[model samples]
Target: MLKQNLQLKLSQKLSPQQIQLMKLIQLPTQAFEQRLKEEMVENPALEGGKEDEYEADEFSSDDYDEYDEYDNDRIEADDINIDEYLSDDEIPNYKLQANNYSDDDEDKTMPFAANVSFHQNLIEQLNTFILSENERDIAEFLVGSIDDMGYIRRSITDIVDDMAFTQGIYTDEKTVENILHVIHQLEPAGVGARNLQECLLLQLRHKTPTESVDLAIDILENQFDAFTKKHYDKLLQKYNISEDQLRNAIDQIEHLNPKPGGAYDNSNKAVEHVVPDFAIKIRDGELELTLNGRNAPELHVSKDYQEMLQSYKHSRDKSTAQKDAVQFIKQKLDSAKWFIDAIRQRQETLFVTMNAIMHYQKEYFLDGDEAKLKPMILKDIADLVGLDISTVSRVANSKYVDTPYGTKLIKEFFSEAMKNDQGEDVSTIEIKKILQTVINEEDKKKPFPDDKLAELLKNKGYPIARRTIAKYREQLDIPVARMRKKI
Candidate 1:
């Protein structure tokens, strides 16, 4: 049996131009510049930098007519007309120009320095030792196994098994252990240590022996658990030492590097540089916002391409080759126009969205006070700027704004709202800032716990719960009171 059914439904879809515009809006200043360079390279019809004065004056829409659609089979020469592309009015400046930057503006570029990696440095040091070929291979393999923190996280049995399977050099655990001991003797004192306790012990062993140093080693080897837990009274009883002697031992342990690999100059790692997309400055006690000039590049259609189209229009040839050439020219010109328009729209969208956010958090920007920030979310800014929440989110997620305080990620300004004792909406950022301040000012000898912190905040009109206080403390990377306790 055959049957036909009719079910009507509505749907929405984005055109190619709309998708391109959204992608452009999402890119920050640096990425946007890279995208611009890529476009110029791909599209010969597109040109960057200021247009020549003569070209600007002589430019006419009649020279570069846009066609609505193209046929796959062939585009007839008669279909192309110079008058069809010509407009009665002059071309808009945005369509032809994008030179927002001034000549005096400095062109800054990030500089990269070449250097060796941490593992390479360790491998080079192996040459100083008289090692056999087999020992050297094992040492190199172990060096490769060392993490950035300079610890060999794997076990001897595993390393031996891997060497047997991967490297085809079978060795016993005892031999690998001996080679590891040699690596531990390398500079940075703790480079080949297996764990934190071993790392601290290796460094202490390298120092000149003193009462405090020896006592520190004894504490680490025997009472490492008690030492780490800050069980000061128990240590004093176990060691039969006075407060001053215990303090000296504690001082030596604290001074030792827990992560020796971090001390090495690993300059080969790539550094991330943040180029702010917008800057907010206080001019005459008022916030003035400006998008980074780099975001607004001067782009225009190539004058030569336009002139070539004009020259072709006057030619008598209506051959297939000429029609194909004209069709190719139309596509590139259309792409160039769409790209320029998209860039213009991206600039406008960035400025308008950031402007709305600036006014929304004007109080905090005026003074570098975190407490002054009001409760805000993506929808709040989206509503203020009359844009979609996703659009606003894309802007906030990857963009940085240079403020008086410092360059900050835009998303840091947004936080969930919390009600105070007075029932006024406050930013969670404000509460966190105050919580950090209280912790900083507390007596380290007897640091305030979460319950006390919550009570103090309640007294100050915040009325936050103890569990919420704990959550906020963890978010701020503040340790618990037990961890914060001092000798």
Candidate 2:
């Protein structure tokens, strides 16, 4: 048998304005400017510029008295007459006024890079060679198979299958290998090799053959594994060569370009430069902070929209069409006002949160010292600002601030705390810096392992475990002893 039961529950929901405010809080400076432009374009009631203080006096709530007439209608009517109100002839043009646009409309042009792709350049080189149509097809397929690293990752059998299925051209491994040889001889000198060893040897073959070149090729081709593992003793024993000879060979190998396709990176993506949201300057031993001017652009409700609303309100008679028009106008006006308010709120929130962080990490900012950064988290700032933790996180995650030292991400100052020898709390960032210094000063020929690193930290009063040392090393991007070893 099924029985009905009463249940109690609690829930939370975000209003539309609250949702929009959350999204606005997370946008960085450039993205926020773009969002403002979009809102202005979508709502003619919104305007952005340095307008005089007249906007405040014009849109005051007390100026709206047209809705007072409808306040007295309290009867529940069976049928409300539309024609009884006003005639169609009295209605004015209901089109949205776009007086926000300027009369001086000058066309602006944007700059863009004009360049060809890496593969296209390779195809152009292939055209110079005199080969049969099948050889050309196989060569083109191989060029397509080459990765951005300029290495051909496919096996000969896979290439054969690819050509058969896609290009509908049947070819054997021997023919594909011959065409690949031609590609390897291209201008880059390492564009068509299958592996790093082959790539290096191909580059060596292009160099003018000297004693060093010959020795480098021999070391790379034979004992490739031992050379990669930096087994200098084995190489010295096998070649019966002096240390200077091995060093010269290794120098030539290092000089050869490992990534032939790196030159074409500009063809795809240009480097992105950071635009900081806040700037700090140390004046007279005191710090001054200012938000980027772009973030504080002046915005207000459109004058034409305000005029339209006021005109619609003061008219004596109202009709169904006018009522609908009034509803639409009020909505756009409300949206424009809410958006401007939200922008102000976002700016205030950002300033408060960043100001708290700046004071918290004031020593680090003043000295450009990572060691001075205190242990902080999102909750600390949330508690200080009387906001939720998630709000603090949204501001901290995407925002960047400029300091007297340099531009830095706000998230960089936050770290977990640990107890030191004195039982005083210290930032883990300080521990990482100490670990980095230890690794950098270690003897390169015999780098210290994790256990030794842990012991050294303990001696310095950190008392960290070996596993934690490894974790911190990885965070700092320091390799293991074997990988960091040198001759």
Candidate 3:
């Protein structure tokens, strides 16, 4: 079948520059700075820092649309014009500076101290133990198997088979288990324990055996399920202990480090610092929003590159090599101009979007109250700012804003609307906050279940279902009422 039909349907397509702009908009402060550095490195014509006063003002954001006119078609050397790039007009001083930060602004960068990793520390401790070549290899293998949480999650038989196959060490389960016991004796009290029960027992074993410590060990070993489930009456019946004695044993168990490896220096792990893209401050009972200075990096096209283009334009020789070189120079210059313009557009979009959000949730920002946050979605902000919903989402998803309360993810401010008893719309965030407050204030010995929580919220005009309460509770990271119960 042969088909050659002219299609006449209106369709929209994103230009390369538009695609780039969307990607740039999605990046948070830290990632955006990294992208900026990469762009400067990849495009030599794109220079960072302030441009000289004498440089041409040709690469303004207004000229960004001109980049679309450039095509891949072959160009004659005579067609190139140097006058377009070279001009006596000076770039505006305000355009050159970011003006986001002042001299008085404090540096937010934190220095992390390097230290031995958890596994490395264990290996060093393994060296201190006087083991034969085979035992040492088994021990090292076991140490490698230990996760960051300081637990050997694998079974003894699994380790045994792995050693025989991977390490070429034919060893039995008993031998591996024996070597594992040696690993369990390492520092941090419970580095090599297989389970929580084992981990707790290991820590208790290291402690100078008090009645409470011994009792705690017995509770963990004999009534491990009952202890974890907080079955106080069952524990009392089984242990034949008084309330105070049981309480002391429970306290001792609670004090033990369930995750021993967590105490070790985490310098080996990649540290992620929260560099907020926007800062929302209350200046004289009014909300003030400012983008991070790092986001507004001073970038300009290289003047020397422009000069090189000019020199090439004036030269009499119009060789193919010269034409190719000029084309490359023109491409780089266009790219630099587009990138600079993209950045400028990104800054404007971010500021404008965030400004709309700030004003939208003005009550929350002014008083630092989560309950004051209005029911807002991406479309609401998009409609307000006259941008696409996807664009608003891109800004909301990855960006963090520094607020008077704390650094908050921008998405946190947006929540689905729910009607109260009075038929007034309210944010789900407000309901969650209130729900959390109710849960926090409830009696630990008799924590409110989902149904009771629903009733309580209903009394407070929320009228949420039992299932919804449970959902919200789970979302808040609060366990079930049974899990929240105390001795």
Candidate No. with top TM-score? 3
| Residue 270 in model 1: lDDT | 64
TM-score of 1: 0.91
Error of 3 at 441 (Å): 1.7
Which parts of model 2 have CA positions greater than 4 angstroms off? Answer: 1-6, 56-112, 266-268
Quick one: how many clashes does candidate 2 have?
0
- lDDT by residue (289-397, candidate 2, tens digit) is 7766666556666667556556655777767676666666665665765676677678788888888888888787778888888999888889999999999888887
lDDT of 3 by residue, 28-105 (tens): 988998999999999998787656466545455453335454466666656766666666666633366555865467
Global lDDT of each candidate: 0.85, 0.78, 0.86
Candidates by TM-score, descending order: 3, 1, 2
Residue 456 lDDT (model 1): 98
The C-alpha TM-scores of every prediction are: 0.91, 0.84, 0.93
Off by over 4 Å in 1: 53-92, 95-100, 265-271
Q: What is the lDDT of residue 487 in candidate 2?
A: 65
lDDT of 1 by residue, 1-487 (tens): 9999999999997767788899998998888999999999999988877654423222234566444443355556567664443333334456444445675878876687777788898999999999999999999999999999999999999999999999999899999999999899988898999999999999999999999999999999999999999999999999999989999999999999998998885435668889999989999999988888888776766777767677787878667777787777767777877888787788888899999989999989998888899999999999988999989988887999999999999999999999999999999999999999999999988999999999999999999999999999999999999999887
Q: Roughly what TM-score does model 3 have, to 2 decimal places?
A: 0.93
